[model samples]
Target: MDTKISVVENGALKRVGKVFAEAFGQTPALLVADGNTLKAGGFETLRSLKEAGIVVRQYIFPSNPQPYADEYAIQIVHETLKQDNSIAVVLGSGTLNDITKRASSELDRPYMVVATAPSVDGYTSYGAAVSIGGFKQTLPCAAPLVVLADTKVLCKAPTDMTASGFGDCMAKFTAGMDWILADLLGVHPIRKDVWDMVQTPLRKVYKKRSSIARREASAIGILFDALSASGFAMQIMHDSRPASGAEHLISHVWEMEHLSKDGLPVSHGFKVAVGTMTIRYLYDQLKMVDINSISLIGGESWADRERAVRSFFKDPKVAEQTVVIAKKKFLEGEALSKRRETLLSIFPTLIKRIDEQLPPYAELKEAMRMNGAPVSPEDIASNLEGLRHAVTGAQMIRDRYTVLDLFYELGIFDQALESLQLM
Candidate 1:
């Protein structure tokens, strides 16, 4: 929880200098942005810092190709920071902030952010979602010390960016349900305070979806606040379990493969939106299953599981990493029996939590559609087949207990996946 200052308001960008001065008095600052984000708020941020008597250095990444959060980008920023003692003030949303988060963390320094969009929740989270060796993962990083977002700027952000943020916010519904499943099964119990921190604002944003589409300042402010609350929840828990679940894991799998459309990489929120819908559909299907009827007597052998992981992930390095993680939670023999028994014992409670936690599948889909989020796999430059693979791959990539694991453990993962009618 390194963040000391968090403000989302109209014209908050005007307070950048004052806020920076308060957070890091008289410290020289490095302003980071790309061409598009530079126009968004970089100049104002620079001007404010200079007016506050702070020396400022600039790192303007080219905007044509759009910056990505990758090891190479982190290296460039890492080298830049190595040459000076200036604290970083990242001026964009997801990509730029992620790069700076990892780069600054490498030097054991805290950074600040002036959000250009309500794009993603990694803004004040403890881990940076980045690609290393072409594999997407969350790398350790310190959350920003100060987070400032001006609704004036946010309301003008590209509609898709706002929609992306909305998608990410909506994901909390499914992510929270996943947590409930874990908590009920005695894997990772929910923390009441952190649960309220994220879930409360999520509902507020859901109510204001239409206003958010209209880019109403109040609605955008609510979206931004909800996104920040998710980050704060992760900070408090020191694990993404508070803010991420299987939906994010599905996004990670797609990110690893560089899922893109129309010559541009797909936004994280778009990918997660699809995952959210997909997971919710699975939850609906889960309700129809009778725990007594499920035959969990035999399951995939470890050797077969290893083969599937190796075959699904083409890159040997990725396959290697996934195999290691998959091995940790691949239950069989007595372990499988015990897990099945526990699931059976908790079946009624699991269904109860799912009922209370998730919206109806059709209603959830309508919400995503009305908010301009992708409602089908095709909307994300992925097909049903690709999504199916992504779901299985997602299960293998993380040891996190999710509904994916539940079906897999029940020995009906393929049946469950095939039952999904996401055309």
Candidate 2:
């Protein structure tokens, strides 16, 4: 639960090299970054390490720069860790940091992150999502030994990236709700400290919606603080449940489908943003949990679920692999079913419970827009199909106790699809 990295003033990134020097003695640093980030922040990081009397070695991901976490990337980072006995220093956020965190953990080397954006909460999480044998999965890993986010530079990050971060942060609202539901059903034990650590900053960000839009120094700083808190929560729980939810699953499904326009991959937070809208809409329509409708649910058979799995992956082997990951990694079957009923049985009345602990959706949307985030699904991409795909896939990727899963279990998925069309 100790958050190692510090988000300091603008010029502090240049001092990271020296800080590492003092912590681990004068040693070389293996700097890992992407092509764009290398230009934006990598050069300065390299210079700072050299000036601080530490040896420097750099390794950027290969080719025309596609940011992903696959076997090839994991192997490359592993090689870099072995090439020299230097501590790994990742200079970008999310994808780059995830790949490095997994690779260095495998190499058993200490690692640190210098975040370039107010991005996803994964900055300090202990697990990494990677495609080991073609299926996207979150493999267990360790948290970074340190995290450094320079707020000045982060405030100026691309609007879309900032928006994605907000989407990821907003996810905590529904995600926490799902966790509480699971707790009520005794599906899993809840950790109150971990939950509050992730949820507290959410209220603060919404309260300063106007200031956040101005990108005032204090606003961006506070936003980043909230983002970091989620990471620390993951470190404490050693699970993403405190942060990720049905929204993240949708993003993964998009990734597997290779769903891009003209070959450009979408941002993770963008997909999650749209997914958040889809799930929230579903939540709004429920008349009741309808515990008796569980038996009326369609596609409860293994063959039926497998068919949905086929739609997600082309290779039959990959399809089987996908099912295996879902079954093993995600908590499914009886437990999720019972919890869905308990949560839904509470229904519209539970809205009061959710409101008591979370910010109003409208206020949160304003905070995100002011912070340069997507306010709706349409704000993320060009078409509604992408949003549809994100919603359906979000349901498939995780076994978390979220409202989306509740909708699917209660036979309202089709109706939800119809509602999405209206949107």
Worst 10 residues of 1 by lDDT: 414-423
Model 1 spans > 4 angstroms off: none
* Each model's lDDT: 0.89, 0.72
Per-residue lDDT of 197-295 in model 1, one digit per residue for the tens? 999999899888788878899999999999999999999889888788899899988888889999788998999999898888888888888777876
Encode model 2's per-residue lDDT on 372-421: one tens digit a residue. Answer: 66656566454677676667766665556666666666666776776766
Best by lDDT: 1
Native-vs-model 1 lDDT? 0.89
User: What TM-score does prediction 2 earn?
Assistant: 0.84
RMSD (CA, angstroms), candidate 2: 3.9
Candidate 2 Cα outliers beyond 4 Å, as residue runs: 1-5, 60-68, 132-135, 287-314, 321-345, 375-389
The model with the greatest TM-score is: 1
